[model samples]
Target: MEVTLLLEATENAFRIMEKARAHALGVLDTAVQFTGEQTRFMEEKRWQVLFAGAQRRKTRFQNFVGTALILFAFWMLLSGHFDPFHLTLGAICCIITAYLFHDLLFANVRVGDMRVVALRFLCYIPWLIQQIVLSNLHVASVVLRRKMPINPQIITFKTKLETDISSITLANSITLTPGTITMDIRDGVYYVHALDQKVADDLNAGEMEDRVAHIFMEADHLYVEDVLDAARIYDALRV
Candidate 1:
């Protein structure tokens, strides 16, 4: 009976040991799984941090270069190579070139490509001239006509635009155009006072929006959406 009791005790101890081993193995497995997940998460975060740092450095470099160019241009201007008229022309040309050719210098940020900007300029210059001339003629016709038929109305509308320079350029263009004037602009909504219904409807229809985007070359590189969206304020009184 003692031998039988001893064998039973031995069997119980072995079963207990087996259960303890299983529990230890389960804990170890869970620990290893947790470590692996942490390692992967840490690696991903490190990669993101590295990428962002690189981008910030690149942007700093671009800003340095842009500033240097502006200073150099001013230096040349002061050196007297270009006279007053020539200086004015040169300055305007410099600004246009900088705006249009930024990608040639600053290669990152995926701002709209320089090639697109160039193409747009090709289209935009002639279009601008045509617009200016046509508007001038329209205003002249109205002024010279026997009856001064004028019906000025203020129209407000929202634009789905997300760039600063482009929108401001658009506002200036609208104000510059004869008979039509921009009365107020807040956010992406513009309050334009048009000489007639035709120009008001045209602005609402997105012709002007598309043109502005095209001129800016849709470069997503700059903080264009924020700058462009917020900087536009034009108020021109139509005569």
Candidate 2:
């Protein structure tokens, strides 16, 4: 009789413990879901605010001024003319160009900072060029081989870039690199045609993606306004 009573009590305790564990798991799932929804909502709200500002019809005078200066500099570089007559004509042309294409000028209000982005992008250019040279040499070696071991395949991957400009930059960089070409980009995904396993593996390794993301501040920025410094860390890691 005592054994039967103990068994019943133990079974009841086991059932209660199982029910408690299930209830705890349910609460945790609900908390996680809530956190995810909140994060998404915040992201959407931030994007909405940025887009609203971009859509405003007011003429951005800063864009006009910056564009005019760049045009003037390019004109001087091409013409090498600094006399009054030439300078006047160059200014006129710059003004006209700025008037017509001011909207296309670099404006990154969404980024909340432009100088950091620009500096990081400039640093990325040299790295990309170096990659191009290395890739070209590799492809040349493959071509020179008697067997011609060229195995082409399309590699597709998703990116975390928040803006179209970043995506376009990444696409162009891939196309510029030898042994690989950007086939297409749709909905934050990129399709690249790689000449061989080496090229495909390099893309899959995501060094370039991380570089572009860093340039755009897609990753965490523990040190503000120190993009070049951050790049140095990455460079060291790569080495």
Task: Report the number of the highest-TM-score candidate.
Answer: 2
lDDT of 2 by residue, 1-239 (tens): 54345545655765675576567556655666767776656655665575466435223555666688878889999998789999999999999999999988765546457778888788888988898898889878998999998899999988767778788888898988868899988888898999988778878767676678778877564353454555565556555
In terms of lDDT, the poorest run of 10 residues in model 2 is 50-59
TM-score of the candidate numbered 2?
0.66
| Model 1, residue 11: C-alpha shift (Å) | 72
Runs with alpha carbons beyond 4 Å of true place in candidate 1: 1-37, 81-110, 217-239
The per-model lDDT (C-alpha) reads 0.64, 0.75
Cα shift from native, residue 78, model 2 (Å): 1.5
Clashing pairs in 2: none
